[model samples]
Target: IIIGEKRLRQQSKDPRTPPSHQPEADITPSPSPRPRPPDNLEEGEVEEVCEISTPPSEVLVVEGQADEPFSTDHAQRLIGQIMVWNGQIDRMRDQIDSMRKRLDTMQQEIKNMIDVLGRI
Candidate 1:
């Protein structure tokens, strides 16, 4: 980001100058990165599966013609969702509490059985 800012400042210093007059250091092309070869291939072998391209872009909204994207109904729906999620959380807590009680009962039964076997 700092390098880009420096380039922008350097360019703005002489905005009217032609590209040919610019210093060679700033105009040099950056190195293209090489993709690694697959392990199955022989040594020094490589394969390019795809090429990078610019992504497509489009305007999502136009001047004065854009419709209102929000409503009171959407807000109400969000509140309703919160209530539904809260109910689900309550149900999960109840189920977990019941499961803990069952586990405790099973543990007590196992201890009793062990005690009976020792007595016999």
Candidate 2:
């Protein structure tokens, strides 16, 4: 009888308790077909490139205007620019790898010297 009354009291208290504290979801829905900023656009410039206009090298959200008023020369220029940038990135990566190997060798040498000193 006592346990039953306690449970009933608990249930009554639960109803009076306020809902769990949680952040309210923003009432506004996120913008659809939102204009994305250009990746290569210079600072202070407001160039909005549609997802469709994104280059093949980029992870495109949506394919931008390809047919309407498209320039073949501009496309070719972008391709050439990507090629040069990719080449530079590859060279820098190689240089970084080489430096890492040199650093590892130097570290091993230091460890060996420390071990020899400990023995002495």
Model 2, runs deviating above 4 Å = 1-68
Model 2 agreement with the true structure over 1-120: per-residue lDDT tens digits: 011111111111344554332323223323355545668878887653323222333221223434233368888999999999999999999999999999999999999999999999
Error of 2 at 62 (Å): 10
Measured with C-alpha atoms, the lDDT of residue 20 in candidate 1 is: 34
Those runs of model 1 whose alpha carbons end farther than 4 Å from true positions after fitting are: 1-68
lDDT of the candidates, in the order given: 0.55, 0.55
lDDT (Cα, tens digit) per residue for candidate 1, span 36-102: 5567888666555544332232112223532443457977998999999999999999999999999
- Cα-based RMSD of candidate 1: 17.6
Point to the candidate with the largest lDDT. 1
Q: What clash pairs does model 1 have? A: none
Highest TM-score against the true fold, candidate: 2
